[model samples]
Target: MNLRQTINSVQAHEKELALFNIDADERIDEELRSFFRTQNVRITTAQTASGCPEEIAVLAAGETVLAVVEVETLRELVDGAGAQSRRLGVTDTAYSEVLSHLKETTFTSCETADMLYASREIEDRARRNGTGTVHAGFQRCSTIVSQQAIYEDLSRTGVSVHAYGVPDVTPPELAGGQVHAVGGEIADLWFVVYDGGSEESQKSALLAEEDSAGRFYGFWTYDSAIVDSVCQYLTETYLGGNGQFPQFRA
Candidate 1:
């Protein structure tokens, strides 16, 4: 199969092999459902930050791994190439919109950074609570340029990183443009298309799917064993039982 096909296949079957969640409680209404039915793609919400409860457990595990890394390096990795904690997107227009939204929104300026920090805290806490091995994979633009930077960053924090792609996935034109802006690098990047339809089609189809299913959601669940293995590697390779990292509480 071609790249696009490969991406689609990967996305369609992501949950078949991985452990993830679909929030069945957050359903859409009928009006939205009817509107979405004519669309070609579906849009569903997934927890991407520390605030979501479903993600809290796994995020905590990620934090435990991060605590062992050097703080200055972690900060540098986050403040990549002098870019601040601003909204990022695949195109100029979208980027602009993200910036505008960030400025106008009430979110904290250090939201992303804090989220990263908290992931470590959460992970540490979870481990203490005896939560069995947790596996978490982060998804972002996975190309060569970003990959090296991301790899270096995650490596310092003791995360075992890998590159994966969704099959048959033609990243949105805007996303493609963004990747280009960063230099056609796909190294540390992993791609997961949230909505598998045209921009116009996605909004409606997503609404319809949510309404029919009585919930709004997204896909892909990774293997818990994979998460455990990666974490174990990091703990053994870098953490080495130093216990210098701060302990986390639920």
Candidate 2:
């Protein structure tokens, strides 16, 4: 399937987040709702029930509670130390913490900065593991240039790196990385997929497409099967019959 089709497949499994035991403060409640609105996560309020914890937010796939977080923590996520700001890392809230709670959840109309944060997280995993294959699509060659340094560093770690984009400008010469200057449908997509090398638990991917200028729609997932599909598609479509990317030595 094409990149867009791959994304649509994941989007079909919709999920919802329900807030519980939150203090009756309209401003706080409204802020929480507004924050989730950007991520396309459905937000609701429910009375603290037997199974659900007080002052917690429950993320559910229908009846199954997939994840939960404290309402106060959720607030800290949306609003950092600065009372009026939506900056991340507020009160010790980490970026990985956000990923843990929001993995496999769809986000609509996200900014480029948001995508960059998610991409870096996956890149960092591959860097630390010092193995695996990384597949990234930057939409344009210039965009790939913007991330050249990180990809170069990843290549130095012996991680195979494949970068894709339309040749809108000259591509960077990444020493141990392969640059696929292709066009057509791939030009509209931005993605990062890591195979987790020999460790299946570390598999993760971030896939998104620009819905409009400066606005992105997509999701980040840690599911191994989902990650496999994305990496497989890129391999078959770009790497050809060999079905293998060139390995780089550390």
List the global CA lDDT of all models.
0.26, 0.73
Q: Which ten residues in a row have the lowest lDDT in candidate 2?
A: 84-93
TM-score of each: 0.20, 0.74
Steric overlap count per candidate: 34, 0
Error of 1 at 21 (Å): 28
Top lDDT hit:
2
- With a 3 Å backbone cut-off (N, CA, C), the pairs that clash in candidate 2 are none
For model 1, the superposed segments whose C-alpha errors exceed 4 Å read: 1-28, 31-142, 164-218, 222-250
* Tens digits of per-residue lDDT for model 2, 1-250: 6678877876766667777766666356677666555443577777755745778777776677777667777676666535422322112236344435454444555577767777887899999999999999898889889889889999999899989888778767888998878876677788999999988988988888876565678777777888998888888877874755432221
Q: For model 1, what is the error of residue 70's alpha carbon versus the real structure, in angstroms, after optimal superposition?
A: 50
